[model samples]
Target chain A: MKPIQLQLKQISYSYNGEKQVLKNVNLDISQGEKIAILGANGAGKSTLFTCMNGVITPDSGEIVIEGKKITKKNKIELTKKVAFVFQQPDNQIIAPTVLSEISFGAMNLKLPQEQVLKRVYEAMEYMNLKTFENRTTHTLSGGEKKRVTIADSIVMQPHIYLFDEPTTALDPLHQQMLEEVLEKLSQQGKTILLSTHDVDFAYRFAQRVIVFYKGEIIADDTAETVFCNNKVLSMSNLKQPILLQIQHILMQKGLLKQCNIFAKNIQQFQKLI
Target chain B: MEKHFEQIDYFAYHSPFRKYSAMSKFIFTMTLLLLCLYFNNIAISCYIIVTMLLINVLKNNIKLYDYIVMLSIPFVFVFFGCIAIAIEIHFENHIIIYVTKQTVLKSICVMARTFGAVSILYFFTLSTPIYQMVFVFQKLHIPKILTELMYITYRYLFILIEIQHQIKIAAISRLGYCDIKTSLKTFSSCIANLFILSLKKAQKHYQAMEARCYTGELLFLQEKQYYNKTTTIKATLYILSILLLKIVLRGQAL
Candidate 1:
């Protein structure tokens, strides 16, 4: 069995203790696992992500990263292991230029300046943001800012990367760009967990799906199985991924019998056609 | 408001001085300003204003008319502020206003100084981006809180402006501002909503920083550049000439 990279035991949190945002949630993430966290607005997805990234300490829970308990003292060290890319690139990007933005996380790790530069360079190359290194961050378009922010996190070279709704405001081209980066990182054996409301994105990209409904994990399973569960979808206030619905409709009409193909994404759908 | 943003963007990104190191430009600005203040000489002050205008028109390629128009906006405000200094008021049987030679001369000196200072600032700001100016602040050993606050403020200023603009658009779209009374209500509500939204945005920004391993100590990428010795030397010589003019050419009654 693979070693657990991250473990959350009976984790719970509430904003100002007014209402329970997270209610006794438990999750175990393994090495190199790709998870898609889906939930409606106010479902505590952001809060849960904060706990996973060590930003928000759970009120009553234990988070163990690679067998070491996450505490305030070691949270800084844990940051080196878990890199979080916030949803709004404008908020997360503090640097004036792209190069500086990418170097920030690595510099925080107390890495040598040269090593920091090296990491930033490689991250820019990975994200194809090398050309924008000299440009001011605010001058960039929305998609470009998203890439720079992603590169900013990638510089840390963390074992586990958390992205909060990265694809939400991105245009189609930039969304495809993000997908390529994620695929490349996944190939590099990095554990990637992203929170998003786009069920189709999760269906096409994530291997495992975790559905959060009012701060509780209502369903967790492989992508195909989770999407096929109508009860889980309704309970979690999530709809089936568009591709799945298309596949189901085609199957019912006996149109896909010739190809026997149920596609997961546009490419798979094209291949089937 | 959108036009204003576009204009600022023009100066920030497209100014010819954007390429020069901010430290050099800032140093020159400081030197010129100090000389103008220390000597309080009319010629040197006039020289400052002229040089600023020349830089904007010739070096930065800004239209002469545009520079004058922008300068005029502040010119009126400063003019009113300096009116008290310019006029000697005597209240006997009736209100009297007189620009006596001494009083007029005093106000002229003050005007020259004010205009000199404003021009030097424009020279620095029109050329150098705000981020680079912040870098210069970092080099000056300014407080982290000050610079970080400045950086965050600079970052959020545009976002807030954008939010206000969007709210205005939405209000107009929904006929929320169709009438004068409704317009007042809509405007007031927009301002109120902006406060709440801005607070939420600030919180999110802090959380994002934390996620990036920020441990309260703010970090930035410093642009690597060596001081242009020639420019520094020329600027030093220029300041010395101005000082020499103040001392050598003084006592010439106008």
Candidate 2:
């Protein structure tokens, strides 16, 4: 097996100490795994990602990336390994101009000037943000800002990419584009971990799904298995993807023979029908 | 409450004097202000005002009407100052005493000088971006902490204005404007909420900065090539000659 890129062992956290946000969470993400964290609102999905990225420290237990324990001593070095894209694009974007925003993370690393520009241009090209290099960040549309945030993170070239609800507020076309970008990144052997409420997005993009419920992992399995589990689905407050819902209905009616939920292409679904 | 005013972009134009360094502009404006204060001659002060207007026209491309309105802002003070001086003179009840030529001329001179100093500063602001001005301050060895605070304050001024607009709309929606008493209460609460929200935002922004590995030091990465030596020299020479001519011509009157 490939070495584990990220690990959280018996981790727990509380915002105010009166109420715990995450409890006894043990998660291990291998190299290049496309994992999706799913949960209802206030389920601590965001809190978990924050802990993983070292944005928030757990009240107890340990978060280890690779083999080193994450502590204040190595937090800055650890950040270079885990890049986080915040849920709100507006909050994450601090620079006035697009090129400067993209270069922000790289520049923070104190990289050489030429290397910073090179990575910025490459990230811009990768995120298809070359056109808006000189544009003011405030003037860009929601999708454009989202892309800029992604470009900002990707410029760091971190080993593990953590996105908190990356698809939120994006139009359908942009959502599809985001999924494609994530897929391409996963294929390049980057460990992509994203939190989302959208079950369909997780089904399409994530290979493994971890369901969070009121600060605990309720289910951790392959996407197909997790979605097929009614208990996990209800606990997570997640509906099955539309295709899966249609598949189940057809299966019940004997219109389809098998209840196989994993279908990547429309032709496969059509053939199944 | 129209946020989008017609003259919104009035300050966007780079002031011709802005091309010079902030230190140079500061020195020039302060010297001109001192000269205006020292001389109690209406003719000399008027000459300075005319020179300022001509510079504004040639450098900033300001319209004739806009320049006139800009110059008129201080006349209210001039009016009050002249009236006060006249009243002081009228205590003896002499007809000529209340309206002495010297008193009138002195008030007009004071007003012209005040207007001249304001116009020069206005031109300075019009030409320089607020960020660049802050950078100039930093380069002048001003405390980094103070400069950073000023920079953030300047950038967020527009953002806070937008927030105030939203807060007003929210207040109006809650029937805040239905009565004068309620309106006053709503306005006070809005002000309180604005401060609270700004503080919260500042905290969040600080956290975001920490997340991005921001230390206390502010890092600027403008290319060294952006500062053209020849252009700066030419701009300096142009501003100096005009300033020299104004001082030379005005000194001749003394």
Compare the candidates by DockQ and give the number of the best one. 1
Per-candidate Cα lDDT values, in order, are 0.84, 0.75
Clashing pairs in 1: none
Two-chain DockQ for each candidate model? 0.64, 0.29
After best superposition, candidate 2 residue A34: deviation in angstroms? 1.8
Kindly report, for each predicted structure in the order presented, the TM-score of its chain A compared with the true chain A: 0.95, 0.96
Any residue pairs clashing in model 2, and if so which? B14-B127, B15-B126, B15-B127
Per-residue alpha-carbon lDDT of candidate 2 for residues A1-273, written as tens digits (9 for 90 to 100) = 889888889999998787999989999889999899999999998888777767677899887888988887787766788888888776676665577678777888899999989998899999998888756565578899899989888888989998999989999999989989998998899999999988888887888999999999999999989988999898777998877888888888888887554574466688776
lDDT of 2 at A43: 96
**Which residues of candidate 1, in runs, are more than 4 Å off?**
A257-262, A270-273, B1-6, B240-248
lDDT of 1: 0.84
In candidate 1, what are the lDDT values of residues B1-254, reduced to their tens digit?
Answer: 45654565567567866777888888888878787787787788898799789978998877898778778877998888788898888999999988977878888888888899888887787777777888889889999899988878777777788789899999999999999999999999999999999998888888888887888887866656457777678778878878777777679642
Query: What tens-digit string does per-residue lDDT give for candidate 2 at B101-165?
Result: 66665566666666766766666665555555666688789999998787566545545676788
Candidate 2 lDDT score at position B229: 66
Give the Å shift of residue A2 in candidate 2: 3.0
